[model samples]
Target: MERIEVIFKQIGTALRIIFLYKIVFLIACFSITTGWAKTITVCNTCDIASLKKAIAVAEAEDTIFIKKGTYKEFNIVVDKPLTIKGENFPVIDGEDQGEIIRITSDNVTIDGLFIINVGTSYTSDHAAIRVVKSEKFLIQNVVLEKLFFGIYLEKSNNGKVYHNKIIGDAQDEYNSGNGIQLWYCKNVIVGRNIVQKTRDGIYLEFSDNITIDNNISTENLRYGLHFMFSNDDVYTNNTFENNGAGVAVMFSKRIKMLNNTFHKNWGTAAFGLLLKEINDAEISGNTFEENTVGINIEGSNRITYHKNNFIRNGYAIKVLGACYTNVFEYNNFLYNSFDISYNSRINDNVFANNYWSSYTGYDLDRDGIGDIPYRPVKLFSYIVNRTPETIILMRSLFIDIIDFSEKVSPVFTPDNLVDERPKMKKIK
Candidate 1:
């Protein structure tokens, strides 16, 4: 039969090459869902003379509308999935030649821009807006000034940097700039921003599940919000003032500091919030005003300082030690010159039911909770904790008669670290 007619002509040429590969994969998915994303407008009477020549003749969901001019242009590369508008705020000048807008692509978009000269490298990290190795991106209402790094987010992931206004007149931390940086990024969503005099107004190093909400980081020269080794992050209602030590949560792990506002952050080693080696944190409803040191807990341990409010601080909490088992409940220790400063007295932490406006304990039968037991670890704070030069005679009178005889014989400060149940008021 002539070899059965050559095996039916090789099965009819394998069904005509599988029907022409399903008609070329359905016309490349119908040319990417029928449109390939259009809208490519640019003014001063033109179509594509600039804006990186309409992003090299746009494609991936195109849209590069630029109207108002001033484009001295630099290294702009929006690899695809585009949408780069600028109807009135277009001024992307990077004549300094470095990074003005270098997004590697993935659903990109940048609104009303104003990125300025950003090129002062010491090996390179230039940016006005650099979202390298991109993922879902969308940087809104941008206005990054004379920057060396602003709105930078390398190795990105689900991004959405909103309402950006990153100012950077950086002077120190090695030649400035960092108003919105997230390295090794993750689920990011830095919202409602307003960063000042840059140098970390919103920085996160090993970013993870980030969500810095309602931001208003002020006068920055260092840390208005500098997150290190980030982990499961979340800082709500933020307002870290006077920067230079306002908010530094280092070596993190499962943190969630809420309702933030740590004021002033004065010098000579300022701090209104600095908890190193933190772990399992949950500092709630925060507000540590007039800062000098209103929360500088080091070598942190199992943390949870709830319902916070510590005003007039020069020192409202400075606990350093091989800290263990932390938990200071229902806080509010107003009017501080020094409310608690421990170095160690061999004690575990648990300052309960707080509310100490200089507790002089006495609420007998008051039913509200203060049946005596307030001792917030003082005794000239254990002689400034073993002679920190005796803190300049902590207001003489022989250091208040040895802190009133260690508050009437309790010997060197940690008599079971009391605070038993002293909240007979103030929780508002």
Candidate 2:
């Protein structure tokens, strides 16, 4: 007609200017995401005075979704960058003078709560999610039963204490405490938590680049994980069971303990890992099972104990007194009543190609080694080193007739503490 109605009015004015420039770029991204959408919803039949007046009129990227009963009120103070969730798991009964969630907020997130009476102290570290001087915080799936110190991170940093469940019916460590206590924190990442009957189920002092992996620190009244002077850390695959001494790394240094599982730390100054004054360390593939002493290296220096798996311990590796230049290679000293316990009868440490489930030498022409020399310090460990009541006749037969007459004349232990390439069997 008239040039097809002027090409349909010039393609309808270029499709209405491309639909008004995509509706003004979607209203400028919904006004920059509704300017950080603030949300506040609390109702367990409402009225804890209107849920503390909707968390005191929330702000800074707000979110206060607290809908589940038992908010028996205590000193609830959360200073800003909010997000105080608790869809269910809401019980903050702090009837013990103050503290029941006192976060001084940077980017806060105190999820699913339940914090019981925690007000004790000679100086007050009363907690149940108490992060003072906060930074990027996140205390996940919370549950802190009848506590004093359960998730107390003072002077916080880039934090992330995940999957929390801290129960502390702690009977005397002089009035229980510490389930996840970190002081002067740093870039922390404590994962998969389950800290029990506390008095120490994860206590780190002077914390640094911490990374405690896959945790399940059991039965605690002490040392389920106690780190002093903490340093560049990385404790992997954790499971420090039957506590009271299953993990303690004092005066720490560059530590990297992989595949961890330090078991039952039994009495008499128990130890399933107590490396005091540690230096450049690396204890790989760990699994010191039935422990009563399976790694108690003192004044550690240049440490390195590879491929570890010292099962059934009653003293598997106790090198007391100023230890130096440590190295025990290809380890697997199973069924240990005493594989290596040196109180310094002088043997500058190094037990090669180890695998001594009581290695009785002789591999003849089979080349898998052990044609003798596998003397891992017995002789009833020198009669329990001068009768600690002779260790209940350790593997009897009069301690195997004086450990086979001190393994053919090498009297009273540490005769160059051998393990010469001894792997004729049990390397499992």
Candidate 3:
């Protein structure tokens, strides 16, 4: 019995030693991962003055804090998981040499830096900040100016670009680049960024599952928000104003655009929102005001436009054919020149429970809906679609007479295209 007790004591001692070794090993790993992380300061008087030198000497997960000064550097590459933060908005001037900062590492954060003067190269898309093939990255509170492409995310996923201001002096589309561009990226959130005067304010190609929210994109040389071949994207509470073309979504599916404002995007060829070959999208509670065309849809299907306000647009909704299974319900078309313009006489879409300012039907039953069906498309609109020069006589009495006569008997407009439940008052 004493020998057995001695043996059990020996076993317990061995287990205790193994557990102690494991605890020590875990401590060593914790030190390598987090406890040994240090901060490197960058300034003119500091030991590591240049950002490139600081990044080169930084260990993994170290922080590089840049002080307030102008550092003329370009082609700065971050190849490790590090935090590059600035105090009082340090300026990193690329001096028109090349790309400012390129992050090729995951779990990196770039915060509160002012980057400028990205080189203009037709061969390459030089960016103020570029995240390439990295995941779990964050770029916030960065100000970028004089850029070719501002904040370009290339094949990066699970990133957040927040509260950045990107402004460019792009004169021509061929020579300039987009302000914020996501190429082949997925699961990204671009929020609260103000981009202006660039080729396109924000552009996405082959990017999926992106959330673009509360961004103010205006005065771009091209579309304010343009995406193609992207799926499952959400754009909410964004303002697109005075762009060449406000927004364009093409060949995308399952997009949700809600509560956005498209205002003052005016040109002969410009539109507030252009949808081409889009499918299964939801557009709700948006306001399109004073645009040349409110929504220009072509080859789009299975879209739901609900509770939107189209105010004083040249053409509220212009369908250029091949649009089917789309529903426009509870919308307010207020004082648009032409409510709906269709090129084809065949109609497969439904327009129900909308309020039109030009609806002349009365409600004798005292309900909110009108008694008679409202014909939204006019013959003069069809004529203007064919002959653009005839828009000069839009307010003339001759045009009104022809429109009245066509309303009496449907000749050019689709005969079955009528709102059966037109609202007497504008939808709130």
Candidate 1 residue-wise lDDT, 1-428, digit = tens: 99999999999999999989989988878977787577888765685657888898888878888888788787888899898989879787897788777889898989978888888787888888889888989999988888888888998999899988888888888877788889989998999889998887988999899998988988888889988998998989888899898889899898899988889888888898989999888999899998989899898898989989999887888988877889998899988877888877777888899899887778879877888888876788777768778788876898778776787678877788888898989887
Candidate 1 Cα RMSD (Å): 13.8
Pairs that clash in candidate 2 = none
C-alpha lDDT values of all predictions: 0.86, 0.83, 0.96
- What lDDT, from 0 to 1, does candidate 1 have? 0.86
Instruction: Kindly provide the TM-score of model 1 when superposed on the true structure, using C-alpha atoms.
Output: 0.44
Ranking by TM-score: 3, 1, 2
RMSD of 3: 6.3
Model 3: worst 10 consecutive residues (lDDT sum)? 29-38
Write one digit per residue (lDDT tens) for candidate 2, span 224-309: 99889989988899998888788889998988889999888787777889899999888988999888898888889888899899
Candidate 2's displacement at residue 376, Å, is 6.6
TM-score of 3: 0.92
RMSD of each: 13.8, 14.8, 6.3
